[model samples]
Target: MSTVTTPKATTRKPPTRFEIRADIPAPGTPEGAYFHYTPAEAAEWLPFSVYKLLKMANARQIPYVDNGKRITFSGMNIRAISEQFTVEPFTKPARAAA
Candidate 1:
């Protein structure tokens, strides 16, 4: 059996930060604009669980056509719902005069 040698650059430290996005336009969005995200993509964007999303969809009965139980949502629809359902921040009320 032959012995393998390690490369000289093995001691070098790798860069800490990495860029993951690409220049490709989103599938459902306009070119050179914001990228469109699918349901799975939306799942990645937010911190909610798939089960939670499903429950929300079921509760609200969001309009979506099914292809043999395979449901699909448009990027536009997801964006609209996300914006509509988001909770706005509230400021504390001023104290009443004593």
Candidate 2:
């Protein structure tokens, strides 16, 4: 009789989230920092979908740069837009007694 052994399978780990840092300027001073990203990259970092991002850009709801051919989003603008749509969790009301 021959003994048989099975090899263990290996799985790849998920990628870690990237963190964003901004250089905030003093009051009454113009901002000098700028970072641009495509819709797909923005979608990866943000919670909104690519379609939603495009819709918002079309509606002028979010700040974006349109260079005649392509549309790009700035990191600062994305942060500002996300802040405007922030929502708190809802609390359920107490059940009525019979």
Candidate 3:
């Protein structure tokens, strides 16, 4: 009679490296998906002027704050507005019902 034993094999995971990138300005935080930006920074990033920026904020609910003399918006808010304007052809009403 004889007894034999075998050692189990071990598996190794491949080496991995991850890189993070950011273009957000100062005084803001990165939430789960979007970055926040102060209103001054928002004005710079946007095409509209300071006054127009205020109007945009009020009209579009662009998420902003108005101090006694200044106003600021969050980058996160801008991202949300962008999503609202984005259109998907497939999502639109079907021209001819299937």
- lDDT per residue as tens, model 2, 1-98: 99898998888742221322344332122442265656765666568887788888899888876766466666676677667788989999999998
Clashing pairs in 1: none
- Candidates ranked by TM-score, best first? 2, 1, 3
* TM-score head-to-head 1 vs 3, winner: 1
Off by over 4 Å in 3: 1-40, 66-69, 90-98
Better model by lDDT, 1 or 2?
2
TM-score of each: 0.43, 0.52, 0.40
Q: Best candidate, TM-score-wise?
A: 2
Please write out the lDDT profile of model 3 over residues 1-98, one tens digit for every residue. 89887988988742111212245453334552344344445556555555666677767556664544344455666656556657767766669867
lDDT of 1 by residue, 1-98 (tens): 99998877657542121212335344346541344333354454445555565566667655332434444444555556667668999999999999
Better of 2 and 3 by lDDT: 2
Question: Which prediction has the highest lDDT against the true structure?
Answer: 2
TM-score of 2: 0.52
Per-model clash counts, in order, read 0, 0, 3
List ranges where model 2 is wrong by over 4 Å.
Answer: 1-33, 88-98
Query: Which residue pairs show backbone clashes in model 3?
Result: 37-75, 39-72, 39-73
